[model samples]
Target chain A: MILTVTPNAALDVTWTVDRLVPRASHRVDQVRERAGGKGINVSRVLASLGHATAVTGLAGGPTGRLIRADLRAAGLRDELVPVSGDSRRTLTVVSREDGDATVLNPAGPRIGPAEWDAFTAHYARLARGADVVVLSGSLPPGLGPGTYAELVRTAAAAGARTVVDTSGPPLLAALDARPDVVKPNAAELAAVTGHDDAHRAAAELRERGAGAVVASLGPDGLLAHTPDGVWRAVPPRPLSGNPTGAGDACVAALAAGLAAGAPWHRTLCEAVALSAAAVVAPVAGDVDASVHRRFRTTVTLVPLEEPDAPHVH
Target chain B: MILTVTPNAALDVTWTVDRLVPRASHRVDQVRERAGGKGINVSRVLASLGHATAVTGLAGGPTGRLIRADLRAAGLRDELVPVSGDSRRTLTVVSREDGDATVLNPAGPRIGPAEWDAFTAHYARLARGADVVVLSGSLPPGLGPGTYAELVRTAAAAGARTVVDTSGPPLLAALDARPDVVKPNAAELAAVTGHDDAHRAAAELRERGAGAVVASLGPDGLLAHTPDGVWRAVPPRPLSGNPTGAGDACVAALAAGLAAGAPWHRTLCEAVALSAAAVVAPVAGDVDASVHRRFRTTVTLVPLEEPDAPHVH
Candidate 1:
């Protein structure tokens, strides 16, 4: 079984309005809701791909119960740790006139130390029964920044492979634990490695103790950095769909690649292909059957040695 | 007992954003939920005022359950008639820049004829025990236009003073039923009366067979006409607080006034005072005790006949 953790979970709400002006009212034509969190998205894709995934996180109030019910209805397994405050609800108002979306995301409930201890202990025990563990999303309120790294350390001791996908301070902390793999977007990699160039970004991220680095380059494709060198995996085309959970597809692909025992070269190629397939699909993180099968054929893999002067990311 | 009927209640979700634009994702600074509907607001106020009030409405799905749970938590007596579809959620986005609010109200769950029949029977029985009955709000989807009017007829037949607060065609339907009273805003009054002038509007609404017509004139207070004569109940001050449910506050005052056996002269004055108090209160339908008490004394009840048509809303 694969385990996924989302420190802060949310009921994501989106509305489509004609236009949004300051201090003005807009009639929203459409509204949509989904059980949301980076780890939840990844686990959903994993389930759709025929993998058994167990999700654990903090949830509370009526909104928390709703979120847990949604996850169960979607056929995803969960162990929700209830808290006192309501889980956050994020709003995305899409303006049709301007072709842009304004997002209003509530900061999730503040989790106290006792709650953190409960989750950490429960997750560590749960990890003992899992082959792989995924520590995803931002740190919930009241928890220390090094929370992910501690979880990785605990899971590693339990003989489970850990994969970390996050950004900023949390990602920086997770690097010290040397998770088997770290998947960061181009921007996230740049922020962490302090490199504008993708080639150097991958190299610097790998040097920060990530056993391997898989940098998602949006339309360009994927960059992989290992002990041997660097490799670029190019997809057939750019994904064009609602850009909400595509990154989770990359994370799912990376986990699946690791599970398949493929070589780094082959794994990175499959990750890029799957991510591209998800982007072109209607819903975020959705991989069409035909595209998934066809993408396996066209993904291009190019390998290179680590440069003598490791490029500054 | 003041029984308030909210046929299609909502879980009102309010979000505060810097600005609103269509098709754009906005970062909501704050998100909160409360049970809402015209009659629901009136019931909340009545409950606050220490009046015995029972709210009946359709509620379903997880959201519907939350609505009932919240109403109970707020110490409001409610008995929901469960239905098939999910209860609706109303999203009110407050953008600070323009001081305007955009409302995305869900077309609430479709109400089948069976639900309607069940509610009417349930409500008619409840009405026999009530001193006043308020049938409020617009028609939800799958409901016929004259639903409120039918509810009004049922309440009146049960010997309860019936008050209808709705607009457009539904308002027209209730008028033909000759409800005890109809509270229409200036615009709704104009639509019902076929006249833009406040006095003419009141006459037209009264001609439609309502026992009394109270045409709200916003900051100017109310233009009221009863069997006795026309009168104006003027507010002591024009307040700046949000007036989302001020009209409902007036209707609630009307019910409480009628229950207290106040004559039209005093009922109209009390309604004006409650509305002005609502305007001055920070939250919707919240009539400040001090403000409400103070305004009760300042509301001028000027008889239309004695004034000689000089001026007054």
Candidate 2:
């Protein structure tokens, strides 16, 4: 079973309009709502791909209830610790005509120290049964920047491989805990690696003690830095449409490949294909099994040079 | 004493930022929240201008608590009857360079029938002791379009003069109850009167049986159809800047003048001057007394041709 943690979950509301003219009112033609958080998205995608995934984190209020319902709808097991503050709503004004998404996200509910403790205690018990633990998204208000690092340490101590998908302070802090895997987009990798180029950014993350770093480059596809080699898996074709859940889909595929005992090259290949399939798919973080099989056939993973055993230096 | 009803008041949040680019993140520089509702604004301005104003309506939940706190901070007297649902929040994204306000208002809390009964009881009691009553803004969920009409009838039956400031079906329904006054901006007035132009709109409202119809024309100033005469008052200068609360300011000045037993000219002049002053003021619904005095020098009130019996065909 896989365990995923999302500290700051949200009720994602999408309002689609033909055009968004600032300061002018437009009647929203379409609206879709889902319980969302990075880790939850990854877990749902994994579940859709036939992986047993359990989600644990803080959730409460009406929005929290909706999140749980979404988890159930996605067929993912969820355990939520009740919180006092209302869940945050993230509004996405999707301009379909222009293919733009304007996000208005509220600062999520403030989680107290006690709530964090409760989550950690629950996670510890759940982590004991987990094969791989994924900690994703930003730390909600009141949590220290090092909260993800602490969770990474906890999961590692429980003898489970930990994967962290986050950026900024949490990403920087999690580096010290040295998770087995970390996925940051090219931009996040650049910031973390303190490098301008994607290649150097990937190399820098590995040097900072990430067992492996996956830098997702849009259209250019996945660039994986493993001990064996740096494999750049470009997509079969340049994909179009929604790119919202592409990374989460990649994370799900990578986790699935690792659990299935596929080699690093094979895992990276599947991840690229899964992400591409996700982009063209109607629902985010989901890929048809048949489409997954078809695309897996076309994914080509080519390896690059790894510096040395001192890839760290 | 003037009683203003804000059945569904909100904490209006205005986020001032640069251009809103979809899918791209923005750094919000300033966030301003205030007690908001057309009636709340009118009562606040009335209080600031030294008029005795009392506000009554429903408020509940955490957001409702904040609304009440803001009202107190603004030094406005309000009797917010507690209810179960969370009070609404209206988000206005204002552009820094351009004078544009993009509003995203939540459909307000659902008020049970019991809450409605309680409100009417208190409103009637409040009406009996007030110089005039102003029923404004929309009714919350679970109430019909005629909710404002019902309140107007109740206030009028209690021998209180009332002004209905609303639009759409509610405005039409309130007209049936024949409130002493109805204040709708040009667009709302046009919808109610089936007359898109200001002159025709005012005439149409009066014909439908409104004792006095006050039409707010932004920048162009205020127009009125009263028992004494037909009048139009233009601002001293072309009004520029924020127009968010200009209409409410007009209504508040109208209500205040009526309370003072001011004649048609004085009331129209005050309304037009204060309405213009509101645009020049830093905030909405607030006309600086100094600015009011300055603008008062220029507002020209003209008497239009009055209809015999003031009844429409």
Candidate 3:
């Protein structure tokens, strides 16, 4: 089983309007809400792919209840811990006219110190029964930057491989715990390593103690720097749609591959295909199954020289 | 006691951002939420003025729970009827840079026939103990245009004077029930009566069966057409802030006047002052008490020839 953790899960609300005019009143034609966060999205993708995935995270208040209810309705395993503050929400206003989306994200609820301690203990217990533990998304307020590092260490101690998908300080800090894998998109990789090149950034993250580094380059596809080899996997073709949850789809495929002890080349291929498939779907946490199936066999994988290895002529 | 009914009550959520750029993501700096609707605003104003006001209407689901909780926290009486459908929310995105607000309003829950029947029975019981019943705002989906008319008749049967504050078909329909007062803002009056002139539009509403008509004209104050006389009340000077709840404040004062059997002149003066005070405040259902007091004695009232009376000059 794979366990995914989203520290700051959200109730994602999407409102469709005839047209979006800034600073003007709009009558929403439709409203769609669902439980959302990086780890939850990863878990959702895994579930859709017939993987045994369980979600555990911190949630609270009325919004938290709604998130939990949605999780139950979606038939995803829920092990979210309770907090006192209301969970946050992300409102995406989609214009039916131009298909433009305006997103409003609230900083999630402040998690108390006791709540963090409770979550760590809960995560440790859950990790023991999991082959891989995926720690994803932003840390809520009152949580330290080293939050994922602590969870990564906990998972390691529980004899589970840990996949950390985050950015900035959390991603950098998680490297110290030597997580099995750290998946950062091109932008996220550069933000942490200060390297615009995905190859250098992934190598830098690996040197910082990450067991493996997978950098998702949107549309361009996946760059992997693992102990086995360095590989770049490109999608069969550019799929144009919403790119919101494409990274989560990549993480889902990576975690699945790790759980099955697959080779880096096969893992990167699947990750690239799934990410492209997610982009083909309109909403996050969903994939076009046919797109996934078609791209899976056609994704091109190219072996590359390891950045840190000694020069060979 | 004044009872205000908001059939389509909302949990108004305000998100403040540094700047609003269309089709771009915004990180909300502040989030504020409160129970809101025309009738709820009226009740809130009355409560703030040390009047006994109870909120009664149809509310359901999570948003309704939040509204009820807020009402309880505000120490106002809550007699809201519950339905199965989720209550709607209105999101206002305020840009701090220019102080521009973008509002997104959802068409509220569809009330089942059984729910409407339940609410009417509930309202009838609540109206019996009220001196005045104020029905305000839009009717939820699945409710007819005669919703307010039915409520007005029910209030009358319970010996309660009714103030209907709405527009279009609902406003026209409520008039046939002979409500004690129907308050429409300039635009609302124009929409319903097809008269650009506030004076003529208000008089037309009275001619249609309303016992009285008070048309709020924003910075210009109010125009009252009642059995006693026709009068235009203007504030001392234009004071502007937020005009969102000014009409509700006007209705609040009107309901207070009717409950106390105050004369039309005094009622119109108070209504104008309170409405301006609401404009001075930043939020709806709130008033700057000092502004209200200052404007009360300063409002200028002018008597006009009754529109429907025979000319004797």
Candidate 4:
């Protein structure tokens, strides 16, 4: 079983307006809302692929109740811990005229120290029954930068492989815990490693302590630097659609591969295919199944020579 | 006691961003939410003025729960009827750079036939204990244009005077109910009567069936057409702040005057003063008490010789 954790879960609300005019009033006729966060999206993709997954995270107040209700409606296992503050919400306004989108993200609820302790204990208990634990998304207020590092250590102690998908200080801090795999999109990788080149950034992340590094280069595909070897997997073709959840789809495939102890080549291929399929899906946390199937076999994997420095210890 | 009915109650959410750039993502750090709607705002102002007030309307789902909670926190009476659909939310994004605001309003939840029946029954019961029943704001889906008319008739049968503040077809339909007072701002009055002149529009509204008409002309002040006489009440000077709830404040003062059987001159003076105070308040439903006190004795009241032909029955 794979356990996913989203510290700052959100009730994502999308509004469709005839046209978006800044500083003007809009009457929105269509609205769509769903439970969303990086880890939840990853778990949704994993569940769609027939993987056994349970989601555990911090949720509270009325918005939290709605999030839990949505998760239940989606048939996902809920092991969420409760807090006192209302959860955050993300509003995405899409323009019908030009297909433009404006996103407003509020900083999530502040987590009390006691709430963090309670969540840590809850995560440890859930980790005990999981073969793989995936920690994703931003840390809400009141949480330290080393939050993921502590969770990774808890998962390691519970004898589970941990996949960390976060950026900045959290990602950099999680490295010392030696997570089984770390997946950062190209921008995230550069932000943390200060290297614009995906190859150097992935190598730097691996040298810093990650057992494996997978950097997702949107449209360009996946770059992997693992103990087994270095390889780049490109999609069969560029797809045109929403790219919101493509990264989560990539993490889902990576977690699945890690759980099954698949080789780098096979894992990278699955990640590339699933990510491509997600782009063609209408909403986040969904994939075009036919596209996934077709692209799975056609994904081109090219092996690359190891970096000159060979920084791996 | 004054009872205000807001059929389409909302949880108004405000976010303050450094700047607003269309088609870009914004990280909002400050968020403020309150129970809001035209009727609710009226009730809030009335309550703040030491008037006995209660809010009765249709509210449901998670958003409704928040609305109820906020009303409770504000120390106002809550008589909201429940429905199955989630209540709507209005988002106002304010740019700190230029203080420009972008508003997004969603049509409120659709009320089922049974829910409307229940609300009608609930309102009738509340109206019986009230000296004034105020009907305000838009009608949600599943409600007809005659919704306010039906409520006005119900209030009359319960021996309660009604003050209606609404626009368009709803305003037109409510006129024949012979509400004690109908308040429409300059734009709303123009839209319903097709008269650009406020004096002509108010006279037309009174002629159509309103016992009295009070038209709020922003900055210019209040115009009242009533059985007693025609008068214009202007503030001592222009004050600037937020004008969002000024009309609601005007309605609150009108309802207070009706409940106390105050003469038209005194009522118009109070209405003009309160509206000006509301404009200077930082948020809707709030009044700068000092400003209200200062303006109350300073408002200029000019008697307009009846429009060539008197239209009052």
Predicted structure with the largest lDDT when compared to the true one: 4
The complex in candidate 1 yields a DockQ of: 0.41
lDDT for predicted candidate 2 compared with the true structure? 0.80
Encode model 3's per-residue lDDT on A31-97: one tens digit a residue.
9999998899999999999999999999999999999999999999999999999999998999999
lDDT, each prediction: 0.80, 0.80, 0.91, 0.92
User: Where does candidate 2 chain B have its weakest 10-residue lDDT segment?
Assistant: B304-313
Cα lDDT of model 1 by residue, B1-313, tens digit? 9999888788888777777665555556676788888888899889888999999878888788888988988898887688888888887777778756767766777888898788777888899999999888866788887787788888888889988888888888888788988888888877766777778767777787888888878888888888767888898777766666678889998899878888888888888888877876645656787878888878988777632356554
Docking class of 3: medium
lDDT of 2 by residue, B142-219 (tens): 889998889888887888788889889998888888888998888887776676666777777777879999888788
Off by over 4 Å in 3: A306-313, B306-313
Interface RMSD of each: 3.3, 3.6, 0.8, 0.8
What are the per-residue Cα lDDT tens digits for candidate 1 across A150-215? 999998999888889888898999989989888888888888778777677776767778888888
In model 1, state the lDDT of residue B144: 82
Task: Output the worst ten-in-a-row residue range by lDDT, candidate 2 chain A.
Answer: A304-313
TM-score ranking, high to low: 3, 4, 1, 2
Model 1, docking class? acceptable
After superposition, which runs of candidate 4 have C-alpha atoms over 4 Å from their true positions? A306-313, B305-313
Number of the candidate with higher TM-score, 2 or 4: 4
Model 2 per-residue lDDT tens digits across residues A265-311: 88888888888877777656566566567777788787676644343
Look at candidate 3 and tell me the lDDT of residue A92. Answer: 92
Residue pairs with colliding backbones in model 3 are none
Better of 2 and 4 by lDDT: 4
